[model samples]
Target: MSTAETLDDVAAAARACRACTDLPLGPRPVLRVSATARLLIASQAPSTRVHVSGTPWTDASGVRLRTWLGMDEAAFYDGRRVAILPMGLCYPGRLPAGGDAPPRPGCAARWQPRLLPLMPAIRLTLLVGTYAQTHYLGRGAMTERVRDWRRHLPRFFPLPHPSWRTTGWEARNPWFGAEVLPALRAAVAAALAD
Candidate 1:
């Protein structure tokens, strides 16, 4: 795809991207973004359900993420208010042992530089998984990054992936609920405030 000057052009180019031919579900490039968006959900990748639905965060993970952000589906999905951009736009397929595979190595490198510049309104980016946290904030334990969320303030907020697997982690880290979530919701609300 050629250089796209506008968000619509970038999004169109992204939707038509076929760079990663090895993707198990093919290159669906699922994402939701707009130039006016202020809150960015920087996640790992689309799940099988999101790939099939062609909508970012359309599964159980999304439910929990929205809950964490104190956002309803309407607000969460509004491209003008929020953007969902993952490390990999397409579903990378499942791991042999159990869970989904990590995102393709080249996807973010190819797209983020192009897409993010178009979103000048973005105030806070929520790094929603290990992939995202590592990509944006550099290598670190997700628990430590999330626990020290206040440090990355006014720009990025690190959080564990909101998958079913995270339930155990959340249970173990009671501070996530008792502390991080309230701050997260407030920051999100402040970012989205008109």
Candidate 2:
């Protein structure tokens, strides 16, 4: 597709993207964005389920994510209020040992610049997981970045990916629930406030 000048145009182009032919499930880009979006969910690549479903955040991880943000499924899925854009639009396949592979190197670089400028209303971006945190905030340990989330300020909130694996991490760091969550919810409320 040609250069996209509007949000709709960009979305269309992203959906049609076939740049990554090596993707295991082929290219089924899953994302949600709108010009009015105030909060951005900057996540890792979609899981196989999400690629098949053609919707962003449709798995267990999504459930926990919505809980973290104190939003219902309806509110979370409302593109006008929240934009869900991952580092990789398509599923990059699984690692031999386990877990999903890292996002394709070029996907975000190819699309973020085009999409972000059009989303002038985005007040805060949630970097959900190592990929997003690294890409946006530079190299750092996930725990450190999340622990020091306040330094990123009203513009960004660093978070661990809400996969089942986090259950253990949450237990280890009780402060995440007691401190970071409340602050995160407040930040989200402020960002989404009318």
Candidate 3:
């Protein structure tokens, strides 16, 4: 089968996944991929807005991420260039304290290995936020991991979550803006280049 057709089959299976049948808001897998995609946006999980919209990164955080990559929405969302996949396919629901809960317990370990390899063209993976970084790069502080972006190289670029919570973090770490972002954007451009 063509990669697109194979991915379509995989997506269909993911959409019908009942692994988290007891999820608070139920399961609504939110991911996008294509065989031609060279960039992989590996994030934590879907927020309520993304779940409702059936689109990835449609909120303010998305704006920040797009800005960080110096990409317009069209390019970022283009399936042929980018694949948006999260640690959790569904919105794990809200926490009693406030923010959303962590992505359903073992979702990534269960699904990612099965899904990721299908995209053979992926050359640059933006490991956004703690969950994704922790999963792929192993347990580590977001600051340290993000600071050492060069270590991850052309394959993985670690980044803090682009949520409002990161405003203070970003302010405290000027180097991220002065250093990492430029390299990140350049790598993104290279990966998505025709």
Candidate 4:
């Protein structure tokens, strides 16, 4: 496969990107993609663990996320089927109190517009966090956007971050597990069916 074309080119350029030159842990752009991917996991940013491993979603949050989608790791990480892009590719560092800082705004602003169009096969985009939700859906709280996920339909599906913080959120919003996950899983299966 002559991956040296669009997917590979953009991916390589994105990997080598030091756009946010002085990132706390340095510019290790952590994202995954394949030209043939039909499912796009448009997330927030890499965590320290994911950054160290050079793999997106190799953390606690990822585990919960996989469970939410009812997807096994093999299916979830299958590069040929799924593309994982975050609002920021690199780890933006942690806060003084705790938790990861927000992803650099510069990342999506600089790269997404150019990179996303290259993959026309993206049938389903799981916007998995406020950052992704805000960018794609625009001007809405994640709760409302996620609650009204039917409005977006087959193209875009909004989801909350699968971090521990969501434990409380999930407890409060029973519909997420009872309603959203089932629909999300079905959508994923349908998208990958071809």
Candidate 5:
């Protein structure tokens, strides 16, 4: 198969995936991947709005994430340049505090290994939220304290979940914006330029 054909096949399978029925709204994994992607953004999962919209990070999280990356909506949604594959594709119901739960384990079990191999040109992967960082980054993950992101800063670009709840956290961790985000922006700009 040609590269385009391969990408098409993968995308079709990604769309057809319904592997996580145990989770809240069933498995409607939101993934956008391409062979030409230079940046891979592996987030936790889509919010209820994102799942309904069939777009990854269509909510406030996406807005904050795009701001952090210094990318406008057009660049952020360009699949060829920005491959977005969340750890869990579906909305995993709501928590007691009324926030949505993490992505289902079944989604990751089904997609990750398959998708990573297809995106050869991915230079920088933005591992958003503790769940993604934990799954991708292993033992060094910041579990209880998402603010202690300093240890894993430069390597994989670890970040807190871009929710309204994290506004104070973002303010408290001045280093995240003042220090880490500049490097992330430069890295993103360089990768996109290349």
Candidate 6:
């Protein structure tokens, strides 16, 4: 099957998912990868706007995310080179602290194994938030805190989420933008070219 066909079929399966409906936020469709993807973008979950719009990365976070990766909108959305699968596909809603809640554990447990095996070409995976990092990076006492990005640098390239809320965090963590972003861009460019 063509890559788009593969992704669309996976998305369809995710749409019908009832696995995580028991959570406070009911299930919505999954956002996923094309079979031919060379890079994997493991983000958090859909923002409420993205869930409503039925498009992944259809918000300001997406804009900053693309910029961070040194990709334009068209390149960022190109499924063949970049697969945008969040830790959770649907919006999990907001916490009382005014932050978006973490992705439901159930979604990753149910989906990633099925989806990842399908993408043979994924060379570089960007773990773009705490949830994605924690899931992919595994539980280690040394790398548990998001602030300990130094511990997991280069290999998985853990990054803070590209949300407006991160502006303050970025200001505080100047080394992230100064050091990590250039390396991230180079990695993305090389992967896309390959």
The digit string of per-residue lDDT tens for model 5 on 28-77 reads 76888989998888888788898799988889888998888888999999
Model 1 lowest lDDT segment of ten: 2-11
Would you estimate the TM-scores of all the predictions?
0.97, 0.97, 0.95, 0.95, 0.87, 0.85
Question: lDDT score, residue 168, model 1?
Answer: 95
- Which residue pairs show backbone clashes in model 1? none
Off by over 4 Å in 3: 1-5
lDDT digits (tens) for residues 68-171 of candidate 3: 99999988888888999999999998889998888887889877877888899999999999999989989999999999999998799999999999999999
Model 5, CA-based lDDT: 0.77
For each candidate, the alpha-carbon lDDT, in order, equals 0.93, 0.94, 0.90, 0.91, 0.77, 0.77
Worst 10 residues of 2 by lDDT: 2-11
**TM-score, predicted candidate 4 vs. hidden true structure:** 0.95
Candidate 6 lDDT tens digits, 67-111: 788888888888777788888877888889898988877788777
Off by over 4 Å in 4: 1-5
Global lDDT for candidate 1? 0.93
Worst 10 residues of 6 by lDDT: 140-149
Quick one: ranking by lDDT, best first?
Answer: 2, 1, 4, 3, 5, 6
List clash counts for every candidate, in order: 0, 0, 0, 0, 0, 0
Report RMSD (Å) for each prediction in the order shown: 2.0, 2.0, 2.1, 2.3, 3.0, 3.7
Candidate 5, run of 10 with poorest lDDT: 141-150
Cα shift from native, residue 179, model 2 (Å): 0.4
Q: For residue 121, what is the lDDT in candidate 6?
A: 85
lDDT of candidate 2 over 1-194, digit per residue (tens): 96649889988999999999888889999889899999999999999889889998899999999899899989898888999999999999989999999999999999999999999999999999999998899999999989998999889999999999999999999999999999999999999999
Name every residue pair that clashes in candidate 4: none
Candidate that scores best on lDDT? 2
